[model samples]
Structures are given as C-alpha cells and as structure tokens.
Target chain A: MSTARANRMTPYLFLAPAGIVLAVALFYPICYMIYASFLDWNPSQRIGEADFIGLRNYTKLFSDAAFRESMWVTIKFSMVVVTIEMILGVGLALLLDRNIRGMSVLRTLFILPMMIAPIVVGLMWRYMYHPTVGIFNRTLTDWGFDPIPWLADGDWAFASVVIADVWQWTPFIFILSLAALQSLPASAIEASKIDGATGWQQIIYIKLPLMLPVLIVTLLLRLIDSFKVLEVILVMTNGGPGLSTEILSLRINRTASEFRELGEAAAMSNLLLIVLLILTFTMFIYNKAQDARMARLRKVEEEV
Target chain B: MSDKTYDRQNPAFYALLIALVVMAIGPIYLMLATSLKLNVDIMSDSSSLLFMPTLRNYETALCDFLWYEPEHLRRCDPTFGRALVNSLVIGLVSTAITLVIGTMAAYALVRFRFMGRDVVSLWTLMMRMVPPAVLLVPVFGIWTFQFGIDGSRGGIVLVYVALNLPFVIWILQSFIVQVPIQLEEAARMDGAGPFQVFFLVVLPLIKPGIAAASIFTFRVAWNEFLLANALADRNSRTVPVTIVNSLTEFDIDWGVIMATGMLLAIPPIIFTFVASRQIITGMTAGAVKG
Candidate 1:
C-alpha cells in the first residue's frame, strides 16, 4: 500500500520544483502585469499605492500618437523582415537542397551570425553603417557615388535595421526549410520525376506542398521572435533619428524606464502579448488539426 | 536514400556558393578585423585588409584580468571584466538549475500519465510566447517590492530559469518520450527506485537532448538584455547590459567596444562550431515539432 502511494506521488514529486518556480516567477508576474496595467502606476510608487484608474492607460495608449506609431513600426518591421527572410531563406533552401561537399562547413559558418550575441550583431552593423567610416559608404565613395545615410535618415534607418535583421535571421529559415526539403519523402519526388516533372515542377507540385507545414510553423516562430527583438535595434539606432525605428519593444522599454509610466508600459505589454497569443494559438490549432489528421490517417492505414 | 552521391554542379554554382559564404561572414570578419586594428587604422581610409593587428583593444577591455599593466593604459575600467564574470555565473547557474528541474518535470510528464498534462502543455506553449519585454514591467515591480530580490544575481537567475524552463521542459519531453520504456523496466527489476531509474537509465539516454537544451538555455540567459537591464544593478550587470549602457556615451571607442562585443560573441560562436549539428537539431525540433 505504501509502495503504491509512493508510486502515485512520484510524478508530483518530480514536478514540484519546476511548478513552484514557474508559479512564483512567471505566472505570478504575468498576473501582476495584467492587474498593474489598469492602474496609474509608476516606478517610484509601490503597486499598492498606485491609483486604480481602470482602462485609462489603455484608452490613453489608443489616443497616443507615439504609441500608435510604435505599433505600426513594430508591425511594419515584422512584416518586412519576415517576408524578406522567408523569401530569401526558402529560396536558398530550394536552390541548395542537393547533396554537396562542405555543406556542414557552410551550415556552421551560416549559424555564426545568428549564434553571436544580438548586441554584437548590432555593433557589427553599426560599424558597417558608420557614415564616413562605414564599409558601404567607403565603397560608394570609391565608386564616385554619394554616401547613403544608412542609419541617419529615417527611411534608411528602417531599411538598415531590416537589413541587419535579415542578415542575422535568414539563416534560421534557410536551415529549417532545408531540413524540411531534405526530409521530404524521396519516393514522391522519384514518382514525379518518373512522370516527367521538371525540377521547377517538382519543387512547386510536390516539394512545396510537403514543406508547407514546416514553413508555416517556421514563419510563426519567426514572427514571434521578431516581435521580441529589442537589443539589436536598441543598440543600433536606439529607435532614433526620430520615432522612425521605434518598435513596440523599444517603446515599452522607453515607457517604463524613460517615461516612468509603469502602467502604460504594462498595458503595452499586454497588447503585445495578445498579438503573440493569437499567433501562438493559430500555430497550436494547426498542430492539433495536423495531429488529428495524422491519427485518422494512421487509423485508416491500420484498418487497410 | 542513396542521396549521398554528390551532384555535379556548374562552376557558376560554386561561385554563387562562395558569394553566399562571403555575404554571411563579411560582417563578422569585419568585426574581427576591426577589433584587431588600431584606431588609426580604423580611421584611415587605407586599403581595407592591409593593417598590422594589435591586442591593445582586448587588453583595454580586459585590463582588470591582466597581471601586468600595459604601458598604454591610463585608467582601467573594470566594468566589462566584472560584467563578464556576472554573465558567466548567471548563465551557468541558471542553465544548471533549469536543466535539473526541467528534466525531472519532463520525465514526469512523459513517463507518468498525469491529470492536467494537457493544461501543462497549453501553459508551456503560452508561456513560450510571452516576450521578455512583456515581463519587464511586472518582473521589475514584483522583484522590487514583493520579492526584494531586485538588483541581485539571484533575481536575474530566478527570472532566467523561469523564462527558460517552459522551452526546456517542452524540448526534453520529446527526448524523454523516446527513451525506451523496457530499459527503465529492466532497471526497475534490478531493485532500482524511480529516481534511480531516472538518473541512471533515462538520463544517460538523453545526453544529446540535454546538450541541445543547455546550449539554448545558456544562449538565452547569456544574450538576454532587456530584463537583465531592468533587474541588474551596476555591479551585477551582464555583458549585454554593460555594452548597451556604454553605447549611450557621447564619444564611443569603436575598437574597444568591438573587442568587448567580440568577447561576448566568442562563447556562442564556439558552441555553434562545436555542436552545429545539435543546435540545428534543437531548432528543428522546436519549430518542426510544434
């Protein structure tokens, strides 16, 4: 009886430490954030002393032009970056799906940009974008062309940050899509070839359809990450020249730290969290539907 | 899959590959080159590649660690050195703690049929999407007023472990699921308890998973700046926080800063080269599995 009791308790005992930590550190904080969002809170005052000005922060944020601009910038940044990365990454994956020597070496080299600290990535780009001393401008001047203000002009700063992000993260999609492409059941492709399908046709008709699931998940994951991007942009432009490069994360940081408006920052965080949750749930639903389809297919196979 | 046979490629194809490789490594090469060059070389519009290298920047960044003071140094700023130590301690300790509890929790979820496992799964998935920025406000508030653990390494470690645990558990669960049940049963038959079976049998089988998880955990803990910026005081600043703090200066030391940036980049770079396969595996498992 005691042994049975011990056996029943084993999982809980195993789970207890992690559960306790997550509850105190993650779950509690999230709850606190949601509650704090409704209050007129600031960094100087304790949470208890803050006025319970319900929905004012949210209302103020909607009316606030700066917050709206930051949201638009965040959305614009995510869209541009993810779209460009997806195209370049998936295109490269398709192009290089063949067996080649030094592929591992290539992969190792590719991941270096991503594996390095984002701060370092920002630093590298900042140096490369340095107006007078930068590589791009230096080359342009060498060619007798005018130097482009990479991070100085508003439009160029957005483009420059986008370029930096693409450089760092394109490899992520490349590697994933490559894995997806490589893992594709070869028999389907073989059958397609036997049916006189060309390389392009094979990619479009067969390979792409099979890789769709992985691609969607990768896209969503990248979307979530792009929203979370802060350090690189913070280091690069500090959301400056104007509000041109100020994404939501940077705005949130500035709000809490610079503006000292804790409640507004919390509200901004909640809004960002909601957007992410939608993406996450979409992915989750897709996974569930896929799992169900797989189960049903397996059941049919077993029956057959 | 006799796909191992190499394909014949056009010369243009190889040229394209070379171009791609250059595009990938160019900025990193520039950073390394810049870090090696003197301020004079960096400032001068000489030919890009022909400069005598120097370790002066590295010496300047790591001045506190050097036994003998170099002749060029006037005043040594100890911030980078101290930040480096704080980063390592916080990263390693948090990774260790996260892996320990994370593995156990994952094992439990996998090996035992527990109520609320679905709930746990949903929670983990939800938690994974909560950006560090979102946590900045609440974490700052709670750490400051409620926990009183603000401005300490332990506080930073606590948040990191929490932030990383969901992913670690989610990843390790898949690995633990693949551990053959009969092996654990055989161990149990030989008078081993549950913990013994877990530690001795299941743990050894999942070394690759653990390696992958640790790299990711350590990467996040090491690279994270936002929360660390909020949580860490001057004395407890990580490399990322210190680097950001220094960026706000009127006149920047590009060479020394690049050296500091290079130092921060070194571990992850090493990890990538050493375990590129495992890192790729972890990444694929993360997105592809989801």
Candidate 2:
C-alpha cells in the first residue's frame, strides 16, 4: 500500500476498538432502552413476551403523579443545587483569585471534596447528619439547643440531601469559575480599575461578563449532572423521608430493583434521557456558536 | 510602579482571600477532626476545638467483620480488604487500558487526516456527556446476558473503559495536537517508519499530557460508584460500595465507617498531592484551550 493510503487507513484502524465499544455499550443500550420503553415490561416476563404498548408508557408518565413529583423534585434539586453552588463557587473563586502564599495548596484542598466518590460522600455526610449522635445534632445539643430532625422531616430531608450534594459538587463550579476568572482579559480589569471602578464593580462589569461563556457551560454541565445524581442520595437517604428527596435517577433505580417494574423503569430512564438530551443539545449548540464566533473573529483578524 | 502600589494597598484583598480559603477548607478540617475523635467524643463534645486523638477507629476498621455469611455459602465471604484490593486493581488496570487505547486514538485524530474525523470527535465529546445512570439497566443486561461477564472485575473494567475513554481521548488529542507535526516528518525522512517515529519521537514529547490523562482516568475509575455498585456482586465489591454498605439504619458504627472513608480517600489524595501542579494546570488549560 502507498504510504499516504496507509496513513489514511491507520486512523480508522486505531478508532475501531473505541467505535465498536461505543456502538455496543452506549448506542446499543440506548436503543434497547428506547425499544423497551415501548413495551409493557414486567420483571416476571421476558422482554420478547412483554406486550408492545407504543407511546403508552410515555403517555402514562405525563399523568402519573409520582412520576410528576419525581420530575419536579429533580428540577427543583438541580435548580437549587446549581444556583447555590454557582454563587458560592463563583464567590469563592472571585475572592480567592490571587497569588498569595499557600493559595495553590488551599485551592487544591478545596477541590478535594469533588474527587471523593459520591457514595463515600453520601456516607460521610450521613455520619455527620446522624440524628442522635451525628456531629451536627451533637453540636447543637452541646450549644444548649434542641437537636433538629435533619433527615426525618420531609423538608429537612430534602434540604439535607441538597446540602450534601452542594458540599461535594460546589468545587466543580469553583474550579471552572476560577479558571474563567483567571483567564479574563487582565488588561480590561486593570483599565476598569483605572476608570475608578470599585472591586465589586470591576467584577460585575469586567470579569463576570468575560466569564459568561464558561459560566453557562459550567452551569449546564452541573445541571445535567445533578439531574442524574443517584449514588449520593441513595447512600444518604435512600430516597427516604416519604420520597421527599427521591430525584428521578433514584426513582428510576427503585422502580427497577425495588418495584421490579423493569420496563417502566426503562421508560422512566428514557424520559430522563430526553431531558438530558435537550440540555446536551443546548450545550452542544452553545459550544458550536462560540467556536464559530471565535473562528469568525480570527478570519477578521487575518483580513485586517 | 503599578505593581508596587497595588501590592501595598491590597489589605482588603488579603482579608477576602483568607476568608475564602477558610470557607473552602472548613468542612475538610471538620471531617479530619471528626475522623480522629472517639465515637463517644464525637457524640458528646462536638463543640470542643481540641480533643485527645484516638487511633481506635483505624484499628477497628482494619480488624472488623461486617459481613453476613449465609448458611449455605460457607466458604465465600466478603471483607473491606478484598473490596479495597479489587478497587485498586480494577482502577489501575482500566486506567492502563484506557491510556494506551485513548493515546493511540488521540494521535490518529491529531496527525492523520481521514474520513469521519469530525464526526468521531463530536461523538467522543457526546460520550463524555452521557449520564451513567441512564445506561445502568441496559449495561447490566449486556454484561449478564450478552457478554456473560457479569459481577466480575473484568466486567467493571470494561464499563470503566467505555465510560472514561472519551475523557482520555479528548484530553490527549489536545495534548497531541500541541506536538509539532514537523518533528514526526523529520523522523520519517530520516528512515524511521511511522510506528518508530511515534514511539521514539512523538511519545516522549507528550508525556506530561499522557500523565495528565492517566491521572484523570484513574481518578474517574477509582471514584466511580454507581456502575460498580450495580455490576459487582459480593465477590467484586469496590471501596466506595463497601464504605456505603457499612451504613445501616440499625446499629451504625461511625468509627469504622470513618476509618474506611479515610482509607478510601488516601490513594486519590496522595496522587493529587504528588501531581497537584500538573493536574491543576492540565485541567485549567483543557477547559480554556478547548
């Protein structure tokens, strides 16, 4: 074979393993889930034996109160966690965007929570939130205050789980936002300072607007991740306190394993998949738009 | 002149930075403090800033039996030690496989102009975005029925590779592209074949990139919980699953659980500290440059 042709063929050859795995493992399962969602699948029956109920699963999902509640819970959880995490993460980033001694060490330690396994995080917080003997309530009692029902009441349970999630994941946004903050046009911020802009004003007008693109992508990424969170909540609450904290992934998990409704669980997963698909599509488009704009600016520079 | 003036007048900046640092690290300090205390101390004197440290929790974690032996299954048993070993083995092996394959794919994408390259790039990016829970059921079915690799370390390894390959490929591709093509061309013109050029000329240039990608892949596999939890039965449970399983509604043992948490955290913590500079720079550059 010619060298050039051989070179052309090498990439395809190298891509073969990843391509096959993605097809079988990722694409295949998604297709399977889509097909399974169309069936009235029960754990007792084989998939082939299950009745083919086209769109019925989707239709039933729209009116199902439990499904609706779970969806609402997921939406609320994602919004609340992402909102608080973004604020704290960015606030922390803005405050810590500096070159002080030991800053790097502190930044590394800050992101340690994100590196721990979600299940481990869930366990860690559960110990800290233990009702009678957990550090939180114990501290409260030590302070001569009543021990609050952290994981018992519905609202408290939801808030507690959210707190655990925010604790673990806020570092994600912090790192990304810090990167964005550091990469902002340094000259622009300096000019804003010379223009008599205070620190807060410089942040609002100069740094944040410049960091908007990264912030949007980070927010969308966190949103998609939060929607699919299961392990932490599973380990912490097991979707307990009367299902008050049962987000969609946890609900889907229980439906498959606990309720033994494999087909319905598959259908619910597809619904979650669609929601994620929309978010992913939005992110993809946003990325493409940003790239195209950058390319256009490059072309303009070249022409000039 | 601007630098000196700014440095002298940044008192508020220093104060804000100190406050941010404290807030960021406060929880971890709490976790470390809590981990060092006795269970009774943790429960009783939670507000006290100082305490007599105890190594009893670590001792108990190392020498404890939190297993259930079914009457029929006399010979088989599970322990935290086995799970920790399994997690380390699986994580290392999967990361090795991912780095080799992903580096090759990344090199091809960077150096070779071929059909479907753009599509492949887009697909890999999309793969990173796929939620793991969405694939839990189907993956379980695939492993059990189709591949017959269910509940094995090998099965978990395959899943980790499939899940982490995109990240590996994406990061390595950027790193590989930064390597000048002319160097490979020079090696080829000097009688080196493509493979020889890649091995001798190109690989050495991108070691930092490969290191960065390898650490990330290892971290992902090590810290992954859901797929391991779903795929691995008692025989092949991972560290995260074992630690999580320690918690029960009845008769919880906080000491052992904290000890295991400390153990589970040590590897990643050590890796991070050792490669803190490289990993942080790689991640920050990957985000902005991409």
Candidate 3:
C-alpha cells in the first residue's frame, strides 16, 4: 500500500524543491512587495516597523510629475525601440531568408551583441558616445562635420540609447522571424511560385500573413524586455539632462536605493508589474486564440 | 522559392550583408581594440589603427590575480579581481542549483500530467516578465530582514536561483517532453526507483536543454547588477557591480574600464560562439512554438 501511495506522491516530490524555492524567494517576495507598496516603508527600518499607508503611495505617484515623466519616458522608449526593432528585424529577416552561405556564422556573429553583458554594452556605448574622444565625434571632425553631443543632450541621449538598443536587439527579431520563415510550408510556397506570384506579393500576401503569429509573440516579448531595460541606460546617461532617459526601472532603482523610499519603489514596481502582466496576458490569450484557430483550420481541412 | 533552388544574388546583396556583419561586430571589435590600446593611443586621434597593442590594461585590471607584481602599477585595487571570483562562484552555484531543481520540476510537469501545459507555460511566461528591478525592494527587505540571507553569497545565490528558475523550468520542460516515456517505463521495469528513472534515464537525454539553461542562468547571475548591488556587501560584490561602481567616478579610465568590460563579456561571448545553435533554439522555442 505504501509503495502504491508513493507512486501517487512522486510528482509532488519532484516538484517540491522548485515549489519551495519559488514560494519563498519569488512568490513570497512579490507578495511582500505588494504589501510593502501599501505601507510607508524604507531601508532604515524593518518591514514590521513601517506604517501602513493604505494606497497613499499609489495616490502620491499619480500626482508625482517626476514619476509620470519617467513613466512617459519608459513608454516612449518601449514604443520607439519595439517599433524600430520590429521593422528593421523583420525586414532584414525577409531580405536575408534566402539560402545563403555562411548563414550560421552570420547568426553567431549577430547574437554576440546580445549575449554580452548589458553593463558591458553600456560601457562600450558610453565610450563611443564620449563628447571629445568618442569614435563618432572623432570621425565626424576628421570629415569636417560638427561633433554632436550623443549622450550629453537630453534628446540626443534618448536617440543614442535607442540606437544602441536597436543594434543589440534587432538580431533577436531577425533570428525568430527567420526561424518562422524557414519552417514555413514548402508546398504552399511552391504553389504560390507556380501561380507566378511576384517576390513582393509572396512576401506581402502569404509570408507575412503566415508569420504574423510569431511576429506578434516576438513583438510582445521584445516589448516586455524593453520595459525591463535599465542597466545600459544607467551606465550610459544615468537618466541625466532632466530625466530624459529615466525609464521606470531606473526610477524604481533610484527611488529604492537613492531616495531610500522602499514604499514608493514598491508602488512603482507594482505599476510596472501591472503593465507587464497585461502584456503577458495579451500574449497568452493571443496564443490560445491562434492555437484554437489552427485547430479549427485543421479540423475543417480534415473534414474536407 | 523551392528549398533546393540556388538563387544567384547580385553583388549588392553581398555588400549589404558585409555591411550588416560589420555593423553587428564593429562595436565589440572596438571595445577589444580599446582594451588592448594604451591610454595615450586610445586618446590620440592620429594613428588610432596603427598603434601597437599592449597588455598593460589587462595587467592593471587583473593585477590581483597575477603572481608577479607588474612594474607599472603603483597601487593594486583588488575589487575587480574579487568581484570576478565572486561572480563566477555565484553564477556557477546558482546555475547548478537552478538546473537541478528545474530539471526535476520539468520532468514531473512533463511526465506526470498534474496540470495543463498551458497553465504552467502561462505561469512561466508571467514569471519571466518580472524584472529584477521590481524584485529589488522586496528582495532587499526580505533578505535583509526576514530570511536573513542578506550580504552573503548564499543570499545572492538564492535570488539568482529564484530569478532563473521559471525560464529554466520552461526550457527544460520542452526538452524533457521530447524524452520518450517508453524509455522511462523500461527503466522502471528494471526495478529502478523513481529517482533512478529520473537521474539515470531522463537527465542524460536532456543535456542540451541543461546546457542552454545553464548558459542563460549563468549569464543573468554574472551580468546582473541591480539586485547584486543591493544584496552584496563589499566582500561579495560581483564584477558587474564593481564595473558600475567604478563608472560612477568622474574621470573614467577608458582603457582599463574597457578591459574590465571585456573580461565581463568574455564568458558570454565564448558561450555564443560555442553554442550559438542551442542559444538560438532556446530563444526561438517559445515564440515559434506559440
């Protein structure tokens, strides 16, 4: 009887360690964060000592201009970076989807920018954007053009970060879309070609429509990641020139560490979590819908 | 459009490809070059490409590890070297812990139908989106106050394990699912216990998944700065935190700093070259499968 019962208990036994760790380190901390967001907390005091503010932190955030500006910056950064990366990445994928020599070598080279540490990426970009000794300004001056303040000016700093992010992340979209492209139905493509569909038509009508599901998922994944970006911006501009590049993540760090307002940082974190949860849920629902649609299509074809 | 067709591309396409390759790798090459250059050569506009390379910057960055003291150094700052050691230990330990538990969890989830795959996937995806910054405040409060694992390598390892568990579980599930159930049943028929079935049968087959997951976990633990900065005391600071701490100084040492950055980047670069296939597979598995 015990041996038979052990079989029933095996799954939970396998799951227990991961479950305990997640419950303690991840789930508990997140719950703690949510609770702490409601309290007036700080690093100087223990959580038990902090007063329960009951949504004062959230209300205060609504009126806080600096917080709102960072939110705006975060949104603007995500939208701009995601849009540009999607277009450039997908376009490059479509352009390069052909059978080419040295493709895997190119892919290896491409992923190097992403695999490196973001802090290191930030360091490289910061040196390259140095006002006087940077490569860009040096080359510009050598060519008789004016040296621009890449990370000094607010607008320029934002653009500079966007460029750096695009360079690092475009390969992600490229690789994903290329995978989707390569895995596509060869019979359908052969039929389309036999029907004399032009290259642009094939891409516009069939290829894109087929790749939309993967593209949407990629777009959402990138969007979620772009919001989490902090280190590179932290190392590059440090959200200087009056909060131009201060995304929500950076703002959260500053609030917690610099301002020492744990409560407010938790509130900011909660807000960011809500934003991400919405994105994740959207991806989940969209994926479910796509799966259902694919099932239905298969059912219909089988019926025919 | 057929898979076997050999399309003759124009020379312009090749030119564009070359340009893209250069754009992709130029900055990394620049960083490597800057790390090799002396401060004077790095600052000088003329002969930027013609300067002889030197190991002075590397020597300075890694002076703590070197047995013989270098002639150029007036003082040795052991912070970077210490942080490098801490990073490796924390990264390796955390990756090992994460993979061990994550593999079992994935095996259970895949082999035993306790819950729908979609539900677990959604959970993993949600957890994946939780930024380390969001965990900063609560993790600081909890680790410092409640769990009391704060300011130690164990504490940092705990957080890294937790941070990486969801993705590791998710990736390993896809890999474990591919392992045939008949093999497990055959092992069971040989009178092996459940643990033997898992460790002997399941674990060996999912090596690639573990490889991919370990690389990712190690990368995050090694590259992470925000939480590590908050949690690590001076003694346990990771390389990333030290790099960031140094950058806060006004007069940055471009050559030495780039050398530090290069050191931090070397492992991930090596992983990319060695396991680019697995890395790409791990990256696309979620989106393409979706």
- DockQ top scorer: 3
Per-residue lDDT tens digits of candidate 3, residues A1-304? 9877998999999999999999999999999999999999879899999999999999999999999999999999999999999999999999999887778899999999889999999999999898888889998999999999999899999999999999999999999999999999988889999999999999998999999999999999999999999999999999987899999999999999899999999999999999999999999999999999999999999999
Extract clashing residue pairs from model 2.
none
**lDDT of candidate 1 over B119-161, digit per residue (tens):** 7777798898899999999999999999999999999999999
* TM value for model 1: 0.98
Specify the poorest-scoring 10-residue window by lDDT in model 2 chain A: A95-104
TM-score, candidate number 2: 0.91
lDDT digits (tens) for residues B1-290 of candidate 2:
12432223277876876775666556556666667787777667445477898766655555434343334333433378788789989999999988887877788877875646557667776777777878777777667767879899999999888888887888888778888888988888898877788789988999998888888888888988777877899989998878766675477766667777778777777777778766776666534654
Comparing 2 and 3 on DockQ, the stronger one: 3
Report the lDDT tens digits of candidate 1 across residue range A1-304.
9877988899999999999999999999999999999999999999999999999999999999999999999999999999999999999999988788889999889898889888889999999999988999999999999999999999999999999999999999999999998888889999999999999999899999999989999999999999999988998999987999999999999999999999999999999999999998888888878779889999999999
Question: Is 1 or 2 the stronger prediction by lDDT?
Answer: 1
What does chain B score (TM) in every candidate?
Answer: 0.97, 0.88, 0.96
lDDT of candidate 1 at residue B223, scale 0 to 100: 93
The 0-to-1 C-alpha lDDT of every candidate, in the order given, reads 0.94, 0.79, 0.94
